[model samples]
Target: MTPPSRPKLSLRASLFGRFSLADTGHDLRPLPQQPKGPISMVMRLGAMGVLLGRTTRLVFSARTDKGDTLRLAHKFANGSAVFIVVAMSFVGMIMVYQSTVQLNRAVGDTQLVGAAFLKLLVRVLGPTVIGMLIACRIGAGIAAEIAAMAVTDQLDALRLCAADPIEVLMVPRLRAGIIAALSLVIIGSCASALAGMTTGVVLFSMSPSTFWNFELIDNADLVQGIAKAFVYGVTVPIVAGAVGLSARGGAAGVGRATTDAVVGCSFAIVVLDSLISLMSHVVAGL
Candidate 1:
């Protein structure tokens, strides 16, 4: 096959004296069109949905390779744990102080402080706080790495080697994400509970056993927190992966994808937590 010609342009070589601008008369190649506003947002959301479905399907497929899964899981877990622990501990302290102040005003007893702190950590803080942490910590990294691979054509090379990108990349990340998120949630829950307990014991002058003695944590709290973790774990990878996979324009695009992934995952965690929490309440009632 032959190639198409660059349409020839014949133009005056002078504006004042030998001044010509970009060959002066040739029509410029059309610039790439960008999707605008609502359309662009909808397209991105649609792409994310598609990738979620595709990755979910790939997750169900049997595989012989466990090395990637295990390695990534360990890597993500180690990277995220310290930050989560520290953050949760601080969060726990603040909650304890605030809850103590409020409850002491109302009940005039520091004993009720433990009950409020326990409920706050188990019901809300454990999942939402951990989810946001993972978004900033892991989600951004995944998006950047995948975007770099896409820009450098490594994804193409993977396909050339007959590897399915979803199986090799997406599925492993999905597994690692869920495992790491769940682990972090458990650790965070403990850190928060311990903080609340310590603060109650020291500042509020409550007994240590008071912390766990309260019936603050019901079965719904446990179930909802776990569900939020799973939802967050699943959401982070899907949003990051889809944005990374679709990245264009080299370094700039990679940066954009990472930013998008972080923002999207954070927003997703909040929305999912709220919706699921409400849904769980409705379901429990029925």
Candidate 2:
């Protein structure tokens, strides 16, 4: 019996055939499943600390894509600025109103309201609020993008191409995050101050001069706020990247990673805030 003749391959297929499995052969190993116990949780936390240390080193070494870092910084600032401004404006107004009302009821003296509020905003409220917002906005994005790459083995492909994923993927984000955090904190703090002043003038019948007082704040408060913003900025990307790099399964895993990233970022922000605040207090006392 005569065998059937084979069909000729198309020129397009012939041209592309050699690279058809270009995405294959790389390690696609998924990380271990999510921790289910105290010990596992502790281990995961330790791993995240190690990852953070490595990323911080790369950032300090200046091993990053400058264009990418600038682009991401712009995106983080522009995308989040409006949200931060609006939310913080409302928060400022509400805080001023409530505190003024309470103080007025108690002592009929709201003269120091602006100064106290500004002090709190500069030291605690502004940075913490901004950090939480960034954690929700940027942390999820970083985790989702990197987790998708991780599950698809693109990270491995980068490794095969002699690219360090930490240097390429994580360092730019860490740098950008710092810039965004500092810029947004400044912008958001101004918005909150303006809003608080407006509330005082309109609702409380207080003069703008009185409500815009800066008497209660000092260099220490400004330094604390900036320090918090800087730390929070560095933390969000590192935690998100760690969560992302450990992603497994598939799309569901990516979603899980994003959730974990936000949660981790928020928890880190709160914990760091307490520790830093404590340290600052101790230093001031000394």
Candidate 3:
């Protein structure tokens, strides 16, 4: 005889869908929506802290697949190169053009434009813009991919094999992301500088040597840029992975996760940039 039919359990979603309940074939249920407001913020922060701690432990104290990390690094770098270069090149050109226009209209001194621009690019624009761009591009890809896997039950398969998905999937991306981000930041910065130099020369008839001056930039600027890029690199994957892993449903869930990843990564970049800049200034004042 067939097994007795189980009772049909009906559950209702709460307002804002935070506690939406669904019945998967194996009694699977969507987790509560991540809450908002101050208390929710605190709770999420604690959860993220735990996640980062676990990831850090896995990366440093355990053996990760070296080949996988390298492969992902290569993919991240190559895939991002053209986008970063072209975008940065345009940014450099626009900034130079605008600065020159403003300087010409005001005090008639364009000599300081390149110097000041270089300083800003190194300490602010290069790292920050690259971070934002990577958040939009790479972060979305990571979220979509992971969300798809999660929705399709592949993550469950990993659990069945006694593997921590974070160790198997996210750790490599974290390592590879850092490597790729640093390299791309350097390349994008060079493209921006060169494009700015060319813009000054072509548009304003400025001497190439004069516009290429590096007088305003120092060790501090270099350190800050690298630090920002490094932080952003680490932040994007973790944020994206977290969002993706939380995904449920099917295609709609993947799309939502991708959008969330972009928004979350961008916000993280802005907050980190502000904090890093604040710390740099505080330290420099000493």
Which candidate has the highest lDDT of all? Answer: 2
Q: What residue runs in model 3 are displaced by over 4 Å at the alpha carbon?
A: 1-42
Which 10 consecutive residues of model 1 have the lowest summed lDDT?
A: 12-21
- Write one digit per residue (lDDT tens) for candidate 3, span 191-232: 999999999998899998898789888898899999999999
Give lDDT tens digits, candidate 2, residues 8-99.
54322222222111223332323234335885567557656766766777776755558999999999999999999999999999999999
RMSD of 2: 10.5
**In model 2, what are the clashing residue pairs, if there are any?**
none
Give per-residue CA lDDT, model 1, range 113-164, as digits (tens).
7777677676778989999999999999999998898778787687668777
Rate residue 202 of model 2 by lDDT: 92
Residue 118 error, candidate 1, Å = 1.7
**Per-structure clash totals for the candidates:** 0, 0, 0
lDDT of each: 0.78, 0.83, 0.82
Worst 10 residues of 2 by lDDT: 13-22
Kindly provide the TM-score of model 2 when superposed on the true structure, using C-alpha atoms: 0.87
